[model samples]
Target: MAPTVLRLLLMLLALLPTIGLGNNAAIADTDSTPAELTIANRSIFTFHATFLGETPAARAQRATAVIEEALRGTDELKVSIDPLQNSYLVLLGNRRAFIVSPQDLEVSGGDTRVAAEQAAAVLRQVVDESGEARNLHFLLKAFGLSALATLIFLVLIKGAHLARRKLRGRLPQLMRERARQIRVGQMPLFDMQFVYRIIDRLLSLFYWVVVLLLGYQWLSFVLSQFPYTRPWGESLNVHLLDLLRYLLDGILQAIPGIAVAILIFFIARGISGFSRRVLERMARPGTLNWLTEETLQPTVRLTSLAIWLFALVMAYPYLPGSGTDAFKGLSVLLGLMISLGASSMVGQAAAGLILTYSRTLKTGEYVRVGDNEGTVTEVGMFNTTIRTGLGEVLTLPNSMITGSVTRNYSRAVQGRGYIVDTVVTIGYDTPWRQVEAMLVAAAQRTEGILDTPKPQVFQTGLSDFYPEYRLVAQAVPSEPRPRAELLSLLHANIQDVFNEYGVQIMSPHYLGDPAQEKWVPQDKWYTAPAKGQSADEP
Candidate 1:
């Protein structure tokens, strides 16, 4: 393995549980100290002995000094197990000794006397192991063992890789066949290749995991070979355990909130579904007289959105990290952006709502707004679409529509057939009654004119050269004829009727009357393309 990878493995191994030597690995010279003391980087104990009113820390220092002195001198070090006292003493020559307390050996899983013997044994081993000669020997032994462990780790990794390569070549066909067996409505629920690819990835992950574990075990074992690195191995194990415990604790703490959020989501979804169904029923005719089927879906959708939003808001506090400043800041920023950018949208939406509730404009209604007149095809939240009389569709913003004057031809038809009117000029020499009768006769000949209301004629103005006569008549509302077609027919009928009567229809701007009178003679009325017989023929 690469050195970087090994270093990473060592770090990772630190998090594992320390397995060797158990909890009694560290020893204390006395029972009064919580602070553990170490000799040559090896944990001795959490034991502290107070002597001559000295603190445990001071006393531990003194014990360490005696041990160092014994090691320096030629005097042999001796560990005497004292069973009655439930402790062991390490003596230097005949004068100096340090007591190793029962609490120190208690971690080794033994009674006080047994612990005392264990402490004595460990002390003798430590004294012998502390010399330069033993250290060099230990260092060399550690390197050799580390090399062997590394070779074993490499072999294991190579095997795992070889196994993985073999599986990769063979597993795809097997995974694909398994995936093909699952189907829905004769369609494959999952792609065979996709399942195979996922299986391959999982296998690769498993191989990597095995390699990492092997590297970790090798690193831990190598560190334990030398006294200087033994404590590091122990700490690595402790820290790994601590990290796992922390992760488990965090997951446990978040479980209740996560569960609550999920429950809220499901409940909100159910409520939305139920409400939509109820609204649909209410939208049917006779169920709720005020609610129209057209408005039902939009209302349901808006209501559902509101319910979901409310549910999320209520559940937000229960979500992990919801109370964090970052989440709050993000929420505030989004709200601010919407408020700033949605002014026109809000106006349009509000206008749409107004249009809906006020019944100003509805689908299928023929209406004129400003210069654009058409049949309203749809009224949406932001815009209203109308197909014009000219076959052109115009999409106008709802806010703009709300601000304009709207004339509904359909509504006018509902009350009284919409009036179709035209104005004409005649010489003042023509009798007023005759002019009125002639204009009304022109309206009566129009195909779409409603006869029951009767056509009316009025002298709208007395111009400089003529009398302005206005003819008004209601068109049949149910008639499917266009306004232009109806007006064209009316104009043709008026011209024919005037020609048969020999009364010329002049304009107010005429400078003088023509030499032979501008009216067409009855014989010449159906000239050329005008093959229809004149009004006076029958």
Candidate 2:
């Protein structure tokens, strides 16, 4: 029993040193267990720490490790380990915290208990210098702000779209009302109102353009915030914005030209209105003989051209290329081309101007030019247009028209008066006196033949089978339908009168008859037909 006890005592004595060493190492490493550390004056304590690299995931893991380390041991005044804190405790003494210098691991103390406890507490509270919590909080706040901004942008865009739709729905009615108001306003200021209308439309168009640009800009900004579209959005926005800006610049540059054009339009409209009124007053019955002359048309045309020319001079510099060297070069080139190719064009134009001032013909006039007989339809600067009796239109160069002989039938009288001449032939057996009487009576019987002019007959020639007699009489010019009727009536009257004297009138063409008797007086042999009996009686 004594030998066994001695062996057991020796074994217990050897295990005691190992257990004490283990306890001391565990206490030194403990950070979770509360410890009281104290420090002396002029002493600094540094807490040694290890951490994962600066990455979000690594930082998160480090935070977790620190928390785990803090909860490691339960000893109230014992030095404890906290892996989450990434630090080791250096308990000096007492309940006081130690002054720990992060730069170096040095410890000093007034008392052992206070220094140990202070060092332990200071180490437990150590934090990284990077301010990870502050950065995370800032990122969360930024995301919330961005989401709010996007929501606001969407609301504004939707509201603008709805407003535009409502405005569009009412646009037609607004236009009509504005137009009526303008029409009823002062006549002299009507042109100004028209210009205002154009400007208003342009402003509305510009507004829509700006709205679209803003919408595109907002969409691009929003897309740039998204991970998928961020890169593409940046590039797309740059190019698209550049193109839109270029378009806007071009439109801005064109404003001067547009203004000049508007001015020209207003001036022309005013002049035309005034001129039309003047012409109407002048053209009233017996007021002015020259109002219908070709001078009036040319004068109006020249006045309008002068106005346009003045406007063009003002507008030329505002055009895209008008002030550039290219414009001068183009002018030179155009001059060369015109000199080479436009001689005929110039001649035609000059002739047209001359024709307009000559007052030889006007529209709706029946004209005979060279071999073509037609009605004038239009007279242009380069050519004259005529509509032929066959319903065909002919365009003749003014130069050609100037050189040709032209007869204007309508210009001879207010209503083109004409003479109707008929020729009748009869055998030599017909008496000349009787034939003259018949022709004269036939002219008097014809409807539309003028009585004041009185009909005349002449013996034209003696043919092989008959003597040719001509009957000429004046007719009313305005009666187009009566011309043919009068001619038929004249021929029928001559036939009836000639047949009463037993003379055959050959109209298809009569050659004098050699076997027929010579001409005689109508009072000697010719007798009237029986009452109610036809001249065809034998």
Candidate 3:
């Protein structure tokens, strides 16, 4: 079994010069990620293809052990490269240790020579460092340097911490004292709370960046002090610079995409402005009845939102990383989340649009939706806010406003006012004309009730005992407080006028009839209140 293994090993070595000879494109297509070869924690180089029957990972493992063994030898090891037609022999002290094939070259030209001078340079560094690691004087010197680096790193980090803490405490006080000077009229140019938050965040970012840079320098210095890990230390610095370069390159590449996005948004903004102007022109008296002053703002907002959304959709493909799977997945995830939350929101928004476009509700108009009655303060996408005369503000969902019966009080008046109404039930024995006259007189006594259109009293219902009278009149001053005050005044006057007429305002309810007649006699037919000819009549 041992003899068979030895023969197989020899055969594998002999076959290395002729194996893995495929074209570069084919080898790269086979596996895009190459396998890395490392010594201890230090990376030496990478391999792209299989040699003989060994995979790149397997080849890396074999090369690592052999290289480490060569470095551990006591005798002086002479390292050299032997080039062949299809491979290169990496010799250590006259012994053919490993082979570098056409597949291993970082060659820009054809796979002609073993143009792995980069690999040779890396090997030479390793050999020199291994020898230095054996020196007691160098080890002591490196240890001292590492200790100094660590101490410096800690001191700098602590100083940054104290500086940040002091800044966090004092910056807000400084800003607060100085902010009063930066004001326009009475309004401050900067809200103190917002400025504090901005300052704190900026300080935190700077502090963390300083800490990270200090930590990186410390770690790199410590690693570089050791011979075995010197390559890793160098790699750390190289990789960080490479990452920063990649980021800058990406930013430069995205410039054209950003410019296109900006251009699209600019055009959309112009179109939105144009549409707003057109709507405003159409809002001129008798130009477009549907596009009135009440609806102009919302129409403009919705139009602008739609135009910007369209522009975003058109410019999506040109945005940086928009084609990446990660970007697509994130977009899909966000869409799913929105869809989950938007079920009721979409309905309410639709109802709000319906209320807006249909001219059902407008801000500052008095309205009664179900039991909620107030002036519409805001007709938002999700809710409608109304402020009542009672000094209470109510937020009703747009869906509820659309579903419930809504009565607009402003419709009955020429100018800004609300229709105020009150209901009363009186015995049938009392003439309805007299009752109406009493109500009209009461309305006349009330302040802010318009008399030109004339107050109206309607007999809404006739029950078993009495008739229901509803007195509806328009109240002016166009405010919530005045409307409430007018209703109270009207009710008070109704009682006083009825008392003057010697008429009972209580609704009569009786199971049995009285022996005497309940009707007013003919002699009293020309009574003072009849045909509203009383002293209060104008």
Best by lDDT: 3
Considering summed lDDT, which 10 consecutive residues are worst modelled in model 3? 21-30
Per-residue alpha-carbon lDDT of candidate 1 for residues 82-157, written as tens digits (9 for 90 to 100) = 3223444444444334555555444554555554455456556666666543567767877898899889888988
lDDT (C-alpha, whole model) for all candidates: 0.73, 0.59, 0.78
Evaluate candidate 1 by giving its C-alpha RMSD to the native, one decimal.
Answer: 13.6
Ranking by TM-score: 3, 1, 2
- Model 2, 1-538: lDDT tens per residue? 6434543543453345467733332122222222222121111233332111122233234433543343332323333321112122233122212222221122232444454455455444332211222356744664675687678777876777676667766766676676667664444425555655686676578667867776777667765544334445576698897898999998998887878767767776787778767866776668876655556667677666776677667666766658689999998998899899788888988999888877777786767788876768898889999887565789988888899999775564435555567888776766888888888887787777767667889999987777888997776665653344566777767765665565666666654554854333334333454245433555
The residue-level lDDT of candidate 2 at 422 comes to 83
Runs of candidate 3 exceeding 4 Å displacement: 1-37, 43-69, 83-85, 101-120, 158-182, 185-187, 338-346, 388-392, 444-454, 461-465, 482-502, 505-510, 513-538
Residue lDDT tens for model 3, 251-337 = 999999999999998999899999999988988899987888878888899989999999999899889999999999999999999
Question: How good is model 1 by TM-score?
Answer: 0.49
RMSD of 2: 21.6
For model 3, what is the alpha-carbon lDDT of residue 498?
75
lDDT of 2 at 43: 17
**Global lDDT for candidate 3?**
0.78
TM-score of 2: 0.47
